[model samples]
Target: MTTPILLFLDINGVIDVEDTDVQGENLPQEYSTVYPVPGTKEFLQVIDSCSWIHPVWISTWGKQSQAWNKWAKTRCWPWAYPLDSDERHQALDLIGHGSDKYLAARWYSRDWQHRIVWIEDGFWLSSLYDSSMGAAVKWAENNSNVKLIDTAPTVK
Candidate 1:
């Protein structure tokens, strides 16, 4: 059997060109018109075909993740579970603004035995200032089970 792989996905620059930094905090309410990155369809297709890879949402959507879900539905993409718990989800500003995604994924997978694939645009956002961010980057680099894939704001 294939090993279970947790895919921690960030939507902003990973799946779409709408980087939170560029698009502002106010995301579009309607997703019907928004398009995804050029190769996103194929990428999603590979994830869909692989039963071992579990995709989880780790984007800036935070408490408003429902909006992301609505967007995913519009694109007919696979459902992505949130990495944040119900309590954390209630908190609006993520955990540490820039380092939230990386930190959350690290904390969430602490006890898990599954392999992890973290895809984020701002994975190293505060690495220089945040020790935890720097540590997380080091950990991902050294750990074979953890793979960090950085995406550009444009996704291509």
Candidate 2:
């Protein structure tokens, strides 16, 4: 049997960018649109076809859909689902942020025996997963599971 790998998914820098959309009364009009990075469809296809990769959405949508609901209405992704609220909450309680992309995957993964890889873009890159400080260099030096993949720019 193939081992299941947990994929922590991020929406913003990974697959989306901001656009002007009404949030609600007295709120800012900013929302995310489908800004699929290069090879996005193929990447998701691999996840769908591969039995070992399990995708868990770790976006700002983890707590509330926010603009994701709108985006989802327009974008179809049958291959992915977010970590449930309880799991997301637990990860947040542990790491103190719902967007703790790296830590959340480690703390709430359904299977630890399987490998975990995160496809994300955020402050973590410079902070080493520090939501509040900068220690990324030191953290990367110490962590064994982190892997970086290079990708092409989105087509305009």
Candidate 3:
């Protein structure tokens, strides 16, 4: 069997952002006003076509991921896959105070042997503020198995 790729997706910039650098701790509340990035449907379609890839939400939405899932469904996005509830809860438990996206992605995926693709827009921004985020950027720079799709926040 082919090794399934883990696609860790961030909603703020990679998907929900259009031309604004929307950042806040309001979480699922902030997500309510987000504008879907153009071509997001096509992106979802691509992931859907690739049966060997498993996509999981790694956004700041956090505990409200189910809300995001429901929103995606409303958009008719091919994003029906939900991360295992037990796994997600366990990973969140282990994740410390800071926004260590990479660390969370690692724990969420459960196996580094499989390729990981982190679709995010705040690597540079996050690096400037969060030390863990900075470390994650540095680590992704050297890890061949972990690929970072650093989408620009200004993506229109």
Q: Pick the candidate with the highest lDDT.
A: 3
Clashing pairs in 3: none
Candidate 1 C-alpha lDDT tens digits along 81-129? 3444663453324344324455577656656697999887755664656
Superior candidate under lDDT, 1 versus 3: 3
Clash list (residue pairs), candidate 1: none
- Say which prediction, candidate 1 or candidate 3, comes out ahead on TM-score: 3
lDDT of each structure? 0.61, 0.49, 0.63
Q: lDDT tens string, model 2, 29-138?
A: 36423454455456656665666776666665654433443333323322223556686676667655433444455565534555666665544343544544233223
**lDDT, model 2, position 7:** 63
Question: What does candidate 3 score on TM?
Answer: 0.65
How should the candidates be ordered by TM-score, best one leading? 3, 1, 2
Best-to-worst lDDT order: 3, 1, 2
Tens-digit lDDT track for model 3 on 28-134?
44554556666665776677577788777776666565455554442222221233567556666765433556656667555547788888886777777777677
TM-score of 1: 0.63
Q: Which should have the higher lDDT, number 2 or number 3?
A: 3
* TM-scores of all candidate predictions against the true structure: 0.63, 0.53, 0.65
